[model samples]
Target: MAPRRYCRARLGGQSRWFLDRGDHLLDLQSAVDGDDVPALLRHLADTDVTWAPPGGAVQVDPARVEWQVPVPRPGKVICLGLNYAAHAAEGGNAPPEYPALFLRAATSLIAHDAPLIRPRASDRLDFEAELAVVIGRRARHLDAAQALSAVAGYACFNDGTLRDYQRRTSQWTVGKNFDGTGAFGPWLVPAADLPPGATGLSIESRLNGQVMQRDNTGHMMVSVTQALVLLSEVFTLEPGDVIAMGTPAGVGYARTPPVFMKAGDRIEVEIEGLGVLANTVEDET
Candidate 1:
């Protein structure tokens, strides 16, 4: 069977499962084995990508449902820092000999069309456009050859950060974990649908319709395969886990005057082929 885009959503207080099949959404809940993304990924891996869609599944109206992060509860939301050479230099640092990594609480994640909150503590909310990988199976000590097989799919991520909070200490967890800052999803494109490691794709971050950061996935200092191989070496990767590959240069804090996202501005992170993840900025109330 051919690969398809998928998502989890809610409509009128009811959570729903949907598979994008071009013209309309096929309600996966109506399928013989109705389940969410994690379950679907598990089934695919065990069965070799053979999925039979619901024969009489209802067609869902996209306008009626609210998008949710494709991976509902990733045990590990691992993020990379300074993965791009230009991004590293912009921050006045040299590319590291090893990947700089951080963790984000699942509480920080927000769905597409949701508001990216600027916490009451600071207005330095910034955008970092990234490509996130969703792990499909349990993996430990993955080798270079096993990296691609462990991946479930790819999605767009806006690592909305509070610069001041991030720098207040050496660690970035506090600044990065403010509720509703991580904007993820709209859809997930299967790993089989793209080139190895999801490379060669154009990734961009735009603020209020103006492009702020743009680059190719190929520019990443630590390739996706490498990150997975390296990450698994230290920790076991589980199904539904997310690995945010890091952003390119042009982050607000590195600018001459440093522009930041404020209330009422629309921020969009787009990864070619995967789809766009867009959200409005709002102040913490």
Candidate 2:
């Protein structure tokens, strides 16, 4: 069976789960809480509910509902850096033997179509298009072969960064964690719906409607399965934990004439199977 697509949205000031049933958006939040992916999947499996037409089940217009990050408050947001060989080379560095890992706070992320704030502290705001893996089951110390089973779905992610701050230190935490910089969602596509590990899909990023970065998932130096297995070696990977499988080449900072995001600019990250995540840039007040 093909997997279903799900989204977390704010309707009438309340966050809810929405099922994309092709013709209509079903309000799954009314049936089950949006927090548990595995539980929601089970509920969907057992239910025989039919999708309601637009404004049938939920009277609110989807456009009126404010979008929220698919996983609003994940326990951990693990990001991979230099996971693509081309990206590493573009940055003037060689591929590392192990994945360069980093952490992003939930506070740093905003939902699709929301504004991504360019911090007042820096003008070097850059965009990174990445594939986000959402963990459905708890996993610890699993091998590469068993790691992919723990993933529930995939989503598009923009690992927005403050380049100047990011280069100030060896640690990337501060530059990568600017509040409301990370743009995630649009929706989550179930793993079974796409090729294993989301490989072979075209992943690209656009700035103000112009293509800025383009690549394929198959080009990742560190594959999703390997990332999960490697990460689990340090600590347990719990449900709701996210792994951003890193960005590709053609980043703004790597260009001959660097191009960074500024206020009023729109940025979008699109993955072939996962859908598009679009956000506008706003200056921090």
Candidate 3:
């Protein structure tokens, strides 16, 4: 099988696009829009569409349209726990004995620019800026060196979470998977173009233009490759699946005087090369 080309764009008055397989030799166009890009993909996984070459210079309206989560329907949203050393320490925890891991159900994902709702059950909602790796191929027990090769691309994901709920449970699942908590991407750039080192990529989060969380991916306790390798060993990693590499410290939950998200708050997550994802907070009714 050749590398698959996945794209999300506005089509037919909705945010949607076609996935082309190598120069349009094969393709699948779908109308699934809003925040269900991934569902459209799974619907046409087995079909192939005829690709048409660009007839002329293609034009687009960036402002009038929007891009969504590359995999609007990922089967599993795998996440790294305590991958960031600083983040772990902030929680009064030591580095992971091994790669701490977890998964966020797909329903928690919201497309770019979607409103991040603050759950009525929790008052300490927070944002975790992370680099998300989109898996490209099925793999199990992959080696560290082969991990990057399995990646299709990378995107900026804001792991919106509720701190109080998360701490109440031994497992981080409930608090981390609140509706509209996962906001990522305006676009998913291919991994081939991403930075090669574990460092140099700057990740930051800002609330109302005030800087909140800032760090380099290099500080991760487990590098991206390491996390992939470890995860693949546990299960068959499928294409379009995502791995949120974990957020650095500075979460509202751990601040000296805890800060939480409220209605009217505008949070922005930015990764150096990748574009920023901005979303507003809306209180749950």
Would you list the C-alpha lDDT of every candidate in the order shown?
A: 0.87, 0.85, 0.75
Candidate 1 vs candidate 2: the lDDT winner is: 1
* Model 2 bad stretches (over 4 Å): 1-3, 35-38, 41-60
lDDT of 1 by residue, 203-232 (tens): 999998999999999999999999998999
Show model 3 residue runs off by greater than 4 Å.
1-7, 18-52
Candidate 2 residue-wise lDDT, 1-285, digit = tens: 544677888776667788765655777665656665556444333334343434455534566667888887788999999988999999998999888999999999899999999988999999999999988778899997888888878999999999999999999999999999999998887777778888989999999999999999999998888888899999799878899999999999999899999999999999996778999999999
For model 3, how does the per-residue alpha-carbon lDDT over 55-94 read when each residue is reduced to its tens digit?
5223344554455667767877898888788889998999
Which model scores highest in lDDT?
1
Judge candidate 2 against the unseen true structure and give its global Cα lDDT, from 0 to 1. Answer: 0.85
- The candidate maximizing TM-score is 1
Provide the clash count, candidate 2.
Answer: 0
- RMSD in angstroms, candidate 2? 3.0
